[model samples]
Target: MAEEKFPINIWVNEERYEKLQTAGLADMCEEMLAGLKVIRVYANSAQRDKILQVFPTAKFDSATTKSIELLPREVKDAIFGKVVEKRSIDILEEFLGQY
Candidate 1:
């Protein structure tokens, strides 16, 4: 049987983007898979807070924030991506595994 693959989609705004970029998340992904795309969206503080609550160890260079949600990847051969509202210490460590 052939192995299945899924496309990843990451949703984040400028503030969050900077955090991820600083942590080298985007760079890591690009290094592993070329031609990957990331989308940015505006998110209010409340929305950002909610996501941050789920990940208390996230770091932020600025007070501003954005919304992010990682869709579950349960279906075979279906495109999916994990959401990241903020760059937490744990998440950063996890991303390091790619190296």
Candidate 2:
């Protein structure tokens, strides 16, 4: 399928912005160049475990794992009932920690 491009605004350090402009492969340099700041990822235990299987280096807090484990199975089922049809959520992850 053909990919779609959309505009997004972001903020970043001037140096990083210049680097992205130099690389030139990114479709949305302005958006990518922005947010040179840290990007936080949140996930629960079972989800974290699956991600770690693929990304062993991913950093996460133990508290988040515990909290996700505490969520009632029934509640999770209801909230994610329709999402199950998608099979998976390949949510965006920052690549090479690039800003």
Candidate 3:
């Protein structure tokens, strides 16, 4: 069976969109919420646990897309950076490794 992948939603502003565009990641942000573009980064359960431990404000919105939301801007930026750098959404392990 395929492994479960939990999502972490990152809202993209104009500046972030430009960066994503430059990185060729703009197309990945196909989802929109409240007029803002969004990219969903997938994480494993272990990574999600680490993230929740690291950022007490973060929560898993199981009712929605089963996404991890409410992360601080800086943390989101770091996750987005990993997305841009790797050109992929499967970045939770790498991002969590730092913490």
Q: What's the TM for model 2?
A: 0.25
Give the winner by TM-score: 3
The local lDDT score (0 to 100) that residue 31 gets in candidate 2 is 30
Model 2 worst lDDT run, 10 consecutive residues: 90-99
Q: Candidate 2: lDDT of 52? A: 44
- Candidate structures ordered by lDDT, highest first: 3, 1, 2
Inter-residue clash pairs, candidate 3: none
Residue pairs in candidate 2 whose N, alpha carbon or C atoms collide under 3 angstroms:
11-35
Kindly list the per-residue Cα lDDT of model 1 for residues 70-94, writing each as its tens digit.
4332310111122333422223223
True lDDT of residue 55, candidate 1: 44
TM-scores of all predicted structures: 0.27, 0.25, 0.86
Q: For residues 1-99, what per-residue lDDT tens digits would candidate 2 score against the true structure?
A: 543221111222454345434555233332323444311223434455544454454433345332223223343342232122322222222221221
Query: Which ranking of candidates, highest TM-score first?
Result: 3, 1, 2
By the TM-score metric, which is better: model 1 or model 2? 1
Question: Model 2: how large is the Cα RMSD against the reference?
Answer: 15.4
Among these predictions, the greatest lDDT belongs to: 3
